[model samples]
Target chain A: MPISLPDLENAIRTAIPVAHLEIEDQSNGCGENYAIVVVSDAFEGKTTLARHRFINEVLKNEIAEMHAFSQKTFTPKQYEAHLQKST
Target chain B: MFRAAFRSSILSTRPSALLTSSPSSFSKSLLIARRNLTQEAKEKILDAVNATPVVLFMKGTPDQPQCGFSRAAIQILDMQGVPPEKLKTFNVLEDPELRSSIKEFSDWPTIPQLYVNGEFVGGCDILLGMHQSGELESLLEKNGVLPPIEGEATKSSS
Candidate 1:
């Protein structure tokens, strides 16, 4: 069963309380794949692996059912720099 | 043609010593063995992780990755000049137990996991970031996995 995009987001939101979050359904119709970019203060001091691990820990059950998952996590400060650079 | 790093040795010591150690060690060994390949698979995975300079556990071989993320990891390694011959890869599809057990061992949730000098470096996304920042190349070279600087070779030889 493909996990709902909202369900995945809500789980992340509940855990990380991200200020900004975007989910791209990269499943190509399978519904089991996703690409996520999440920004939160919770990530303030965490490494990429630690940030991802936190999210993964929060969404453990959902992740097992996933086919492909990729994420880019950022702290609020780092996300601001990224936004500025992209702009 | 990179061969998956094979474990340098086997766990011929048996579980007897661990059994006598403590309940924690007993359960830990059991986690390593788990349900998939049992004793053999764990030992093989551990051996490869320990012996190889750089190891990737992915969905398919480097020349023919079965997944997109795995493909990305290969590209990053290539960009870093981490030659295929120097790398060892384990296709998780070959063993169901390994696929799941690896996540447990590394406390990582994804495939295309990279390990350097026996440390879990993270999966494809972290590797991509590391590659962009030139950290991956230095990581390899620092560990003596990558070849020495080119100019130094001529200087030393002369």
Candidate 2:
């Protein structure tokens, strides 16, 4: 069975307790691929490697079944800057 | 592929087959039998990692990145103003064994894995984030991988 978007968010939120999340299903309803943008205090003071490792650890089971999983993680401040830049 | 590498290492080390009659050469078959593929792959992977400060095991070489993520990674390193000589990329697509075994070596189930000074950095997405935050540059400096960039160079020297 293909993994669902809610399932992906649920897994990340369970692990991270994220302040915000934006998930895009890039698999066109196949639910096999996704791109995620996560913002949370959990990322503060963490290196990119550590952050990715944490998310990977959290979604290990789900990710094993996924064909493509790409993500960009941000601390609250970084997310704010990214938001401001986008606007 | 492991066998191929071992064979090439044997050939390169002993260019003169006539003068080279070492017991080690005779024992190569035994070594091959005793040594598992995973162990050999790990050794090769480590060798590659240690070969350069920034090693990217990607789908293709820097000049012709086959995938979008690999291309993105090349661009990130480029943005850091790193010299091309300092970046060594192994095309995993050329060797199926290296491709699959690299995932096991890094414990990362993805292509386009980046290694800095024998340590695994995260993949392209992580790299992009690090680049944007200026963390990758600092990490390069911390690891003694790259020389400090323009403004930081003067500060460090002064």
Question: Where does model 1 exceed 4 Å of error?
Answer: B1-40, B147-158
Docking verdict class for candidate 1: incorrect
Q: Please give fnat for model 2.
A: 0.17
What DockQ does each prediction reach against the true complex?
Answer: 0.14, 0.09
Docking class of 2: incorrect
> Each model's interface RMSD (Å)?
12.2, 19.8
**Position B126, candidate 2: lDDT:** 81
Clash pairs, candidate 1, are B7-B47
Q: Give the winner by DockQ.
A: 1
lDDT for each residue of candidate 2 in B1-158, tens digit (9 for 90 to 100): 79755563464322222122232322231222212347878898989999898999898888899988899999899888777778888899999999888877776768889999898988988888778767888888887767767666423332
TM-score of every candidate's chain A: 0.92, 0.93
